[model samples]
Target: MQAAPTPVLLSSTPIDLSPWLSALDSVSAAIGDIPALLSLAVEAGRTWPQPGGGRTVVLWELLASVSAIDVAAARVLEPHLDAVAILSQSAQAFPDIRPGAEGAGDEAWGVFAAEAPGTRLEARSAGTGTVISGTKPWCSLAGSLDSAVITANTDDGGRAAFAVSLRHPGVTCEQPEWIARGLREIPSGSVHFEHVPAVPLGGTGWYHSRPGFAWGGMGVAACWLGGAVGVARDFRTGLSAGAEGGREPDQVSLAALGEVDRTLTAVLQYLARVAARMDDGTLGSGAGQSTWSEAQRVRGTVAAAVERVLTLVGSNRGPGPLAFDERYAKRMADLALYVRQHHGARDDAQLGRLALKGDCPW
Candidate 1:
């Protein structure tokens, strides 16, 4: 029989895929259902934005997509983490899959699906004159990842990014001993590197130098939205039970659930509107401002509101080991911590710029 050709993936332009790479880095055993995405495809996660266009909603679109990717990656790597050569092949798999982030930092990229916050990932100069190393936190799929998109202070004092495999020399992983309570599934550890060979990305600070990087940076809202949605679903389960038998639900629980529904809805709408604008390129300069307000910066507002609902139900829903019972309590902890995962200080600065008069205030 003739040899069969392997199918190849192709796209028109080079894109920054660090976002999705971040997703691949997050999948793990904790990832709920890997095949569920295929059987019950999520409309929101399927279509990512292309250069000039994409999906209609903005909130956590990337994060949600990545979260899904985590599920997929988990399906592939969780059982194989103990395999040695498996890690090498895993690193090789990433450069091909996330082709869009060809030149991203090695910190964000991972060769395997597993790793650490300060995991050192380095490569010998293929004599390609490349060197890479650095520290990266939030490496969700650290122990399983194959490589990393890293940033470091270069020899000349400027910053640089490169791709490196964890199996390479000089790479080390600093696993976070304690994982955050909420979003407990995302295993963001650490990575570190020392004199690792690397292929330099375009230049230093490439993380934010590109256009739309701001829009690209904080799309983590979608994952937040997913967890929020999950929380709401869990809450709804509680509410339905609490309202069972027409026994008159408690007023405080009812009221709290209502507010959680209301606030999350508003935030999701904000995400949808801004995302549409971004897709059509119709978003004005202030788009960043609006997105920040809804998607992040003030994400604490959503977090706080969600917290209110969870606390209300957890404390009053009548304890047990059922799904809507004690399990819901865990999600409460997850959301509480997960909600605060974004770059709050930076988002605050952006929001601050709009609130106060600055030299280039919007």
Candidate 2:
């Protein structure tokens, strides 16, 4: 396969991700193979750099590269990497809560922190430790992954993070009838826990109130950007093929490609800048107003750019690729659904509220 485009440089000492990229490319063909993805996640957990540990850019570039290969694979990989980072941070913040060898083991981990209305996961004190019960919504690959870094409502009515093994007898992963066309391979459903043993990671509200939370959200945006890059790659290849076939592209098609190029360029530059700030500690280390506003801005920017690229590619390429080219079609569909994680207007409104409260850089 052709070499992937070089990731945007965020540090003077560039990271050599070619090996990891090759591994990801090899697994792209087996898009839905949970075992292969889990194995890769376990390997990555041992080698991938933690966010804000001076190689934040490397972490995001790795995520983006995976998405560029296969969105579903990235969907399975990103959270595992994020879970490792979370565990690393939690271990440092509360040495007493260190996950010991389990955190650094061969197990594949996931972050199941999404909440649903009327559903709750509660953590209660049991003996000298803690246990969690109730159902957690939007838990992707819950049955396949070995463990997860979960958040639950604590006895004090505040949310806290914990590490729990999914192998526990009290855990039941419900298989839902997932009918989504995009990301069909990655099934996201609810998981029910009944007094499953859990190890607390941080104090109440530390999970959401940590700076890594914002960083992790932006890392997902990087995946969205990478999915768009895959679509853009298809668009470029289609134009070239047409030219080679004596059907020279018209001005409209070239114009659409130009628009895609500019949009992706701007977003890449933004991510690089943000990653640099995160590394240098200019963005602050807490989940305060500034960091929260910046996260919203980065996610909003990348999401908008992904949307624009999707529109340009779909409208310009027409239905040919969508109907005939499987990879291109999958990339387009996956990106459309993945970018929706940004929450569009609601996120914009949140950013607006932060700005009104003097949280924005401007």
Candidate 3:
């Protein structure tokens, strides 16, 4: 079946993402298969536009398109693309860091940067290089992916990013007994690094300080937006089917659909504006408070919009689809868990603080 057309960002130069949509559609049925998803991510990493490049909009659109197909695919693909972007930024910032030449081959990569209490990954100088040791938590697909751009604390009390091979003898990936119903195929388990050799990507505290960090966060919002779109699509499909069956949607359902369309349209426009700003350097490259505030705003807005979409979809469609349609049910569950990455009220409070400090654009 032909893939549904991807939403085009409002740009002076129109980009044709139909090819990517078609490619993702070909493997839509194998959504939960790790190998197939990894293969697609590798292919996309080879040709997809890097965030903050001139084609930032295209990069996000591709992410959203993948999410629209399956949230699990986005779960696997977003971090891979983010890893590529991080490596690219690192290479630009540090002359000695060569992405491909630094033992980071053309294999599938993930970003394992999440840290947990009482668990730490330390990066220490080992002769002319560095090695990371300890446990890194929330490492999604760590066992399956070939490499990762992980963050580890340094001896100087600062954190830095390193590209390390997951297949090394010093590395141990724990089997995840993940009980989460959503994103069941993609397990986020911890990996222990026993002095695993690593190539430093950038200088101290450069991973989270880079401007691309905010851009990457916004890219995740794009995935949320896309997943919501997928849910909204199911609602639309149900409405159309009902109409064809001579059971037209009532005023309440039509109003819910209208609200969904309005919310998605507003978020899409906001994302386009942010992407353009990022590409044109209007968002600044210093990872300033303003950049972070904008990212927080985008994430919070998208998260709220997604929540509304899920609610509308549930209320309008009732429990029939949730109970019977496996794909739709999975989409709903995956998106609910995925958008929680936004941190909801905590993020809103951060934004509130930023606004009070005059960091936000109002």
**For each candidate, how many residue pairs have backbone atoms clashing (under 3 Å)?**
57, 0, 0
CA shift at 55, candidate 1, in angstroms? Answer: 1.6
What is the lDDT of every predicted structure here? 0.45, 0.86, 0.86
23-108 per-residue lDDT for model 2 (tens digits): 66655655768789888888888888888998788888888878887888889888998999898899889988877756748888
lDDT of 3 by residue, 125-173 (tens): 9998888999999999898999999999999999999989999999999
Ranking by lDDT: 3, 2, 1
RMSD of each: 10.6, 2.2, 2.1
The 10-residue segment of model 2 with minimum total lDDT is: 6-15
Q: Give per-residue CA lDDT, model 1, range 203-238, as digits (tens).
A: 555533433333533343444454555556666765
For model 3, the stretches where C-alpha displacement exceeds 4 angstroms are 1-15, 99-104, 284-289
Better of 1 and 3 by lDDT: 3
User: Which residues of candidate 2, in runs, are more than 4 Å off?
Assistant: 1-15, 102-104, 284-289
Candidate 2: residue 174 lDDT (0-100): 97
Error of 2 at 169 (Å): 0.5
TM-score for candidate 1, residues paired by index: 0.62
TM-score of each: 0.62, 0.95, 0.95
